[model samples]
Target: MSLAADLGIAFGRVAFVMLFVLNMGGLLTWVERKQSAIMQDRIGANRASILGLRLFGLFHPLADAIKMLTKEDFRPARADRVLFGLAPFVSVFFALTAFASIPFGDTLRVGGREIPLQAVTLNVGVLYVFAMLSLGVYGVMMAGWSSGNNFALLGGQRAAALMITAEVAIGASIMGVIMVYGSLNMMDIVRGQGALLWGWLPAWGIVTQPLAFVLFLTAGIAATKRIPFDMPEGESEIIGYFVEYSGMKFGMFAMADFLETVVIAGMTTSLFLGGWQVPYLDAAGVRLPWGWTWALPHLLVVLLQVGAFVLKVCAVIFFMMLIRWTLPRFRYDQAMRLGWLGLFPLSIANIVLTGLVLLLWGGRP
Candidate 1:
């Protein structure tokens, strides 16, 4: 492609990722409220409305934006002003940028041109995501340390410890995936998943590497600082890292959390759920392993693939929200034990076992 075309593609991908992540984040806020309300037998977020049409609390996010925006921007008088102000932006920026390497669909061919559906096809996309996630910790640490509050500093310490611990399992689990797929490229992994196992089952990561999937999902939730592992922002007791923050700064932190959830969901879908892969469907038509074939329009095929990817992401997000609402928070000691003693070893063993099986079977990469 020409330089101009490359630039245009880059811009388009960036715009698409931003809008997708933000929209998912907004929708998840509503999902959290509605799901919790349903689980607790209560009405949820139904008061926000426009023109007397509530749309089942669909307007709540907008109302929240207005409320937060209109609130006073508060900061502690003795706090580190620069770091406190910079913290939430750091959180939000990393959350947004981390989704760039995850592929939402396989590819699209329009007219005479073929375009990949991901933002950027980095050779080490998996590593890139890990790097971004690791860097995200700085935001929380800064928020807590800059606040000059003992409680906030404690929360920051917990966050750093939890992330560092969980990341070991997360990295190990993904290493299994990299070994199975035999590539660090996200697109290649997604394409590899398009194959069929035993001429019937779709060769998704969940099927081939179920243990890694579980470990990765668990560690991913911990990395995002969600339920069962949310000691960092234990709002009920321990003051959170952003406890002293208010107004849009606090909103930014909230937004970053939701966006991080979406990113995790997307990554889970892409890595384990056969991203953009509709069974028996390809760019041209449906082709089954049993010698069956059916032609489909190119546009229809593209729609099917994209729809499958989106549906998988939404399903994973729903499951994650359910987990957040249903699971009890882990004690700090228990969380640490699970991360270091439980998940880490399992992830490592999973890698070794996967390698042995692949070696014995001489599996094709």
Candidate 2:
């Protein structure tokens, strides 16, 4: 391909990914409010509407965007101006970029050209995601330290601690899946999972590595800093690392959190839920094992794969939101203990068991 062609493709993929992430982040604000309201038995975000059309509080996120844009961007009296300004951007940037390596679908063949459905297909896709997740902590630390407030600093310290504890478990938990798949590439892992088990069950990551699924989900939730693990931003206790931020600056921090949630959902879908892989649906169409066959057009097949992946990600995101409302916030000590003393050790044991199972089987999981 020519340089210009490559550049255009890169730009197109980047724009597509960013738009999806940003829209999902905005939508999740409404999801959070409505979800919590449903759980609490109260009306939520119904006041905002467009020309008398409420649309089930969908316009509330639009109203919020307008408000944030018009609101004054405030700073602390003694804050480090540069780092304070950069912190939220860093958080948002890493959160959005982390999804680049995740494969949303198998591939699209158009006019003799095969287009991979991911923004960037890195050989070390899992490691790249892990790196981005790790860097997200620097944003929290910077925001807290630069805010020139003791509470903000404490929140930053808490965030740092949470990341350290949770990441170890996250890494260990995913290690078993990586070993089972025998590849670090996200697409490779998904393709491997597309195979059938006993010519009937879809050999998904969840089926082959159930323990990793549980461990990864646990660690992933802690990494997001949501309810039951939100020590860093315990709204009732402290204003959090971005306590001094206001307007869109603060909005960026909030958006980062939501975007991170989406990333987690996508990762969980790709790693555990059969990403874009419909049961019995292949490049041609549905092929049953009982001598039955139904062929589908290539376009329809691609769409089905893409739709399946999106649906799975959305389901994961909804589950995460449900968890947010259902669970109570954990105390600092409790959260730490759960991470280090519980998840970490369990993840290690899971890896050992996985290794043993793989050794005995000596075949693809």
* TM-score, predicted candidate 1 vs. hidden true structure: 0.97
Indicate the residue-level lDDT of 73 in model 1: 97
**What TM-score does candidate 2 reach?**
0.97
**On a 0 to 100 scale, what is the lDDT of residue 124 in model 1?**
93
For each candidate in turn, the TM-score is 0.97, 0.97
| lDDT against the true structure, each candidate | 0.89, 0.89
Instruction: List model 2 lDDT by residue over 237-317, tens digit each.
Output: 656887888899888988988998999898899888988899888898999878699999999998899899989999999
User: Per-residue alpha-carbon lDDT of model 1 for 1-365, expressed as tens digits?
Assistant: 58888788779877887898899898888889999999999998899989999999999999989999999999898899899999999999999899989988877777666878888879998888888888899999999999989888999999989989988888999988899999999999999998888888888999999999999999999988989788999867767788999998999998998888888888899889998899888777999888899999888888888789889989998998889888999999999999999999999899899999999999844
RMSD of each: 1.4, 1.3
> Which pairs of residues collide in model 2?
none
Clashes of 2: 0
C-alpha-based local distance difference test score of model 2: 0.89
